[model samples]
Target: VDKDRDPVLGEFFTTESIETCADSIVRESIQNSVDARSGSRPVDVRFSVGCVTKSETGDLFLGLWEHVSVSDEEAGRLCAENGFRYVTVEDFGTTGLRGDPEDVMGDDGDEENEFYFFVRAEGKSPKTGQRGSWGIGKYTYLDVSMINTIFVLTARGGNGPVGGSGPLAIGMAVLKNHKLEGRAYMPDGYLCEVRPLTDGDDDEDAVLPFGPDSDMPEKISAAFNLQRADEPGLSVVVPYVPDELTYEELVRSVARNYGILIGWGDLEVTVVDETGDVATMDSDSILAVLGSLEDNSEREELIDELNLALWGVGLTPGDRTELGRHPLGKHPSWHTDGLMTEEQAKIIRDELAGGRSLAVRVPVPVTEKPDDVTRWSYLDVFFGSSEKKANKPHFYRQGLRISEIPSDTVSGLHALVIIDDEELAGFFGAAEGVSHVNVSSETKSFKGKYAYGANWLKFIKDAPAQILRLARSSEEDEDAGLAEEYFHIPEVEPEPEKEDEPETDPDDTGDIEDPVIPPIKRRVRPYTIAPLVGGGFSVTVNSEVPEGTVLTIDVAYDMPNGNPLKNWAPQDFRLDYMTVEVEGCNLTERSGNRITVASTGESLFKVSVRGFGSNRDLFVDVSLSEDS
Candidate 1:
């Protein structure tokens, strides 16, 4: 089994990967459809749930009952009498799982093999984020199955008309370890077209998605009442669904997660109940569909935001306000443009102050690894303030709402961040933990994928919050006067050789002479540096740093031995973890106990660093990294 295989013990990892399997199903389905769009046409997804008699489907899962049941006798009786319920998700205007049918391994020249990745492989999705985990979204389909089985039908583009010549179908199961004919087998099982093996070695026949383009897949497709009439897309049937998961929840999931997508007119979805009742959601009906859920006990504030806040998306470049662009690898600061021109900043402040909404086009800098050639990527932020209670920030990458990561909150604030950029989305998407909620920088997807992956991740999540703060507040932090005691190097002429003084004896009553103390060297500081409330500090530059002047700041816990820098260690802390706010200069590096910044020719600049633990006193020393 593959190392990253969705474990059978986990019921296809539903417990590990998602908080709500309902949302995961919706998020995954729409994301796949969007990625596989067939040209400029908007994607349409249909979620239909209904009942099917067990006898009608025949021996599809004849032997997996024991493995599927968790006190399922009640389920068996219900199904036998009233028929088992099934969920069929169908997508339109998408090139169905396209690739060589039998390419089990990814050696098929094509960088992306949707067919192989979805049907034949585990943890090898064709649609990982720009730089993310292998396959986080694909497991939901199988996980939704209580019986650990699902049927798939697709029509690749190269094959004639969709339903006519390119249709292919198969069934997959990821179940608990079990025995077949007294022989043990892993949960990864497949139902494919069976034919005579021409290769004499019977063992060479693997559990592949396609053996032949036969009538079996089509027959199963018809039996499941799938609506894919050769329309060129993938349709999946998750049978034996738990009755507790209703079609309405799916509707709420779609609306809650993809409201922005629907508002943008890029997606359309329909949810159908067992009674054939339909709830259609598109650009016009998104709000209308959600209106029905107003009385719902599960209705959340996030869902309510769809109606509460005025939203605006920038389909055109001019619709969005451009913030400062980050020049990755060049500096920790944004492009020389600064966060925004004074006029632009004022406009943003006026909008927020007037209770108006704003959307920003933020250019996120991306790098594959530390200090590599930088590539630019873009993510958008939509924010507004209200008189209502404060709330935490909400983040979405590739159309899915990521719940974890930002724990900080601000009052009367509402913001939605969308990372539609494929590269950054993928990187961050992969960072979403097994719960598939919070974005993490410690994951393998982040560790070596980019330079300062951790820092960039925090910045993106905090961008909207920071922007809101910038617009509403204007005050420099009060500084603790510590420069006089730390940065300056005091010096004095070598103390005159002190005449030896006799030590006082136990019986003597004479007073002892004080020892001669050496004076510290007096060093010069170009600017005043003071400590902030937290472990951070601030630097006030009275004059512009020369073009070639490189400034480096070092911080360490003040040791009683006198020389604080002598025993500094990384195990104690990192500069990046401390809150750093720098303007008029780009922080080039934050490592170990030092922060290096490049001068940006600003005549007067203020730099602040905070968020350090207040328990310990830190000695912050600032100096020039290079000659001016």
Candidate 2:
């Protein structure tokens, strides 16, 4: 039984690493507390750390450990030697534990009593719309304890008879065989044993202390300050904290798990040490906490911005019709009601109605192109930044992120999917236990289908192309696959140059064959428009050339809409070089990579050549002034 239960219980947490145990504890505890909230007020949860020093308690803690410990003699000895460190989590403004005491031993209990089901019930939860849909989170309390013991005390409301007095229960969870008979024989071999009440019957010995009529052990109350007094809530004390887990780790872990809640003023979490209040996570204190941590500095600014954008200044009522345009370009957006593919739109509308669906296209800046692995690291850091490149669509149910397709799983431009509909929740495999999103069945590949439920591969596969077209670069089109497409150039008609001198008749009669007049010609433009590679304009010259006079032509690239291709270096086209060719003119000297042409004995001429450097073999045409 011990061997069978060891591995089974070990697999309860998402991570086995000791560093993340505090994170698990924080996520599970806060989730339960938030779900157990009673009134309209937000939950106030506090995570504090303290030491049980021998000098302060006078061996009371050591004696208590010796009294409760079972099967592990060395663990008990260690507790006596060093008085033990503890982590106490308290949640105020919640309904305290209330339930029948005897129901713990049986299968069914009062449904309204959250306390009995929370601690005693296994594989069942009584709360609705809770973060913890599955009951696996209840195991975290015991798993985080080094000695596998937890001390629970609750103050119920004034409804039932036990509510007026409050109740306290101790449970030590360790995997060991039940012994029928022993020197310290206990019923069912329970590690936790309750002391009998002063005025109670024999049957009430093992039940949790109840009501103002009964008194709690003075040593227990004094050691932990567990007295509820007038307040009604629950307090959990974990004895024998793991040596490796520190208070700093606890604070950061809590921040990572519930920072969204903290930033939005939904909850308040305070970390208290022996000295005083160490740190607090709230809406106003987010910047200070962000600046204090060195590792997540880049992520801090993004979190602050997102929190404000999402929760603080959210979209106003009746504003859903007006779409928000990104600064870069107008990304393509569609709804099930739109006219794009009636059949598909109807399916989407029926399945995910009342949800705002969007596919945004965000271009990658050329400055920060790290290696492939480092690109995905930002997802882990930022977690839920709006610009985070989720290759496949991410699903958000009720403004809370539930499912996301990893970048590596699907390729192409970055896209986002945030749906506010309750109907679409089950379509994305969100009903898979408490993990929310189901893991792929193939352990080796993350790109496989979901473990269970509808994967919707075809629906997500077609969305990127629709959105990617909105921010498509000027270089390529859909079918040609990265081939440059030329932008239309408005034709330039050169006005006939005003001749300075009037026409003169040939001297003495027309004996020189009427001085065969040369027709003015225009050069055919060689290069494609500059907009092909990036943002810019191209010029075409139609100036006439003078007889026997050399003309020098120069061309250069310019950026009109800032530097979009800063990452690309300018290089000469290897296949096609720029040159000047006249129909009836001599190809004269070429200097500084520019062409110099001279009319040699011919009446009419036109110059033609391949485009200049970085023009990608476009044809440029030039005509001389004399030809006009």
Candidate 3:
């Protein structure tokens, strides 16, 4: 069928810069596979990136012209001449696209098939509780392919109609080749047409791709390296993969983005190149890596609850309900006292209670010390299985990440909350049918109906304060010593006895040895230098200084070889505008080259290296001690 797309389709996917185009392809395709999961089997997805000879690729196109005529001769010629290198994402343990090909429109939903919807329908999905509510995410494949085309091959893993049993379908979806030389003709935009299994297969001009019986044909299975005839699944072939994009990056992105799901036995993703199996990600290995990081015992219990929910472990009714509550143990309205009317906030609080997901707070990375408990971010809050991806907060629908919040919107160790409650899914400016991608750069303003009376921007602005309040409260209870020092006043010491202790010199005491005095250790450079954006490092000065101690901090560029990057050193790294936020302390002075801060009590020291145009923060959790 000829499906004309709006001219705007060209600019739709361009909204987000595709630096990680391969990553998007991997995520989007895998999300579809996972959503089409059948029975209790976890989706097993594989990405195979390899080159193909010109003739080899053209072999599948042998009878393509029989159905749709090509207008762009050069494009047609290039396909046959170069064949093409391709990235194929395939899934096992899924019921392959099923249904009668002729029944394109079905008033009765049962007669409609997955193939019909995917091939003919736009802005629709058949799966419930799935990530792809908007059909737009499917275009990711076409957008990444140089030819703007994709091939689908599938076999019914389950039962089909009498003649449809063991059905296998091969189809191609391609953007229409608009002609420029001939008399003007309206462009069809794009069209999807399946290869014919036989001439008399169906009454429609098109013939559905099906084998004689209930299993995939040997020839098709062998060409694509698909499951044996007995096994059932779907394989998607994306041709003309950009040379700059590599399979390794795709593997890494999957591991980082979906590692949590992998670790919890929810799914398995593997990537292969010409050499061999390039990389594989599973649940156990990811868990091992997380277990190796420095521990946070205070968050361990809550983390355990999250882990349990991920693995589908049996839970009590209370635990299930708790999943819908605020992960940091505070609602967004709690910080809206000054931002909104009490009645408005009360309405927001009541509406938020209808959600069915949790928010997670992940601490910014810091030098490990057992006693200190302070979060580096303003709120230290984010949503997901892990906090490492906080730099680019991704949006997910049903545990599958879809879009990333623009980096410009994420600043200064800020928190990212993934919204996934059934009640709240459609409220965040999601596209027509997709629940994952939110077109709005700013998410504070809710577009859903429940937000009619409430001010969403106010909620977004004030939610951080609420998260910070709860986080700070938890920190205080867990580390009372540090909190007490930062906020409590010290008692004055008693004066020495005036008469009895009249300034006696040590020399007057016979044979008295002078007490040994320790020499002061000066740290000219930071004890730890963390690299941030713009070739600068976040330098922490006097990380272990005592209460009331004055600290001098300098932000500079340093090389990994322990030498100053001389070329970069002369250029000023903007540390003058470094924003300082302290608990139980104050900044006495801040200038271009140096910063001086004094502690009132034991305090948590947080110095941001803004002088260098870097957005990262250095957390120096001070240790407290009373000198005798």
lDDT of each: 0.66, 0.45, 0.47
- Backbone clash count for every predicted candidate, in the order shown: 19, 20, 16
Error of 2 at 360 (Å): 8.7
lDDT of 3 by residue, 1-628 (tens): 4432324345445555543777678767777777678768668888888777755443555644322345444445554445567788888787766676555453324422676666555544455334554445667877677666666666665655433645454544555544444644343232223454343445546535545452334444455565434456677777777876677667655754565456557788878885665566666565443343346641342233235335333334332211122223223333222333344333333333342233332222111123333222211124223322112333434555444442222223323444444433333333322324434523222233232213332333234334333333222222324323222212233434323334667668578667655554442432233433322233333455567765555433333443232323424443333333333345666554555666554434434332233332222222233332
Q: Ten residues in a row with the worst lDDT in model 1?
A: 486-495
Candidate 1 regions exceeding 4 Å error are: 1-19, 63-82, 128-133, 159-165, 196-203, 208-213, 296-311, 315-319, 327-337, 434-436, 473-628
Better of 1 and 2 by TM-score: 1
The sequence of per-residue lDDT tens digits that candidate 1 reaches over residues 283-346 is: 8888777667766523555554554333555346775788877654554533233676666667
Tell me how candidate 2 scores on lDDT: 0.45
Predicted candidate 2 versus true structure: per-residue lDDT over 1-628, tens digit per residue = 0111113233445532333667767777886777667787767888877777666555334334543355456565666564677788888877766665534443333445665565555555554334554454666776677766666667766565343435554443543332323554332222244655445566655544333444443344467655355466777878677775567777776665566566656677888875665788777885567567656633453354335334322444332221222222222222222313333334323322233332222221111112312110001011122332212333333323333233211121223344333323222322333443332323211223232212233223233333322122222322211222432232456545444554767676755544544465553443223322222223222333356744433333333443322322335221112222234455564443345566654444433333233443323222334332
In what order do the candidates fall by lDDT, top score first? 1, 3, 2
Candidate 1 whole-model C-alpha lDDT, 0 to 1: 0.66
Q: Once model 1 is optimally superposed onto the true structure by TM-score, how far is the C-alpha of residue 484 displaced, in angstroms?
A: 28
Candidate ranking under TM-score, highest first, comes to 1, 3, 2
- What is the TM-score (0 to 1) of candidate 2? 0.55
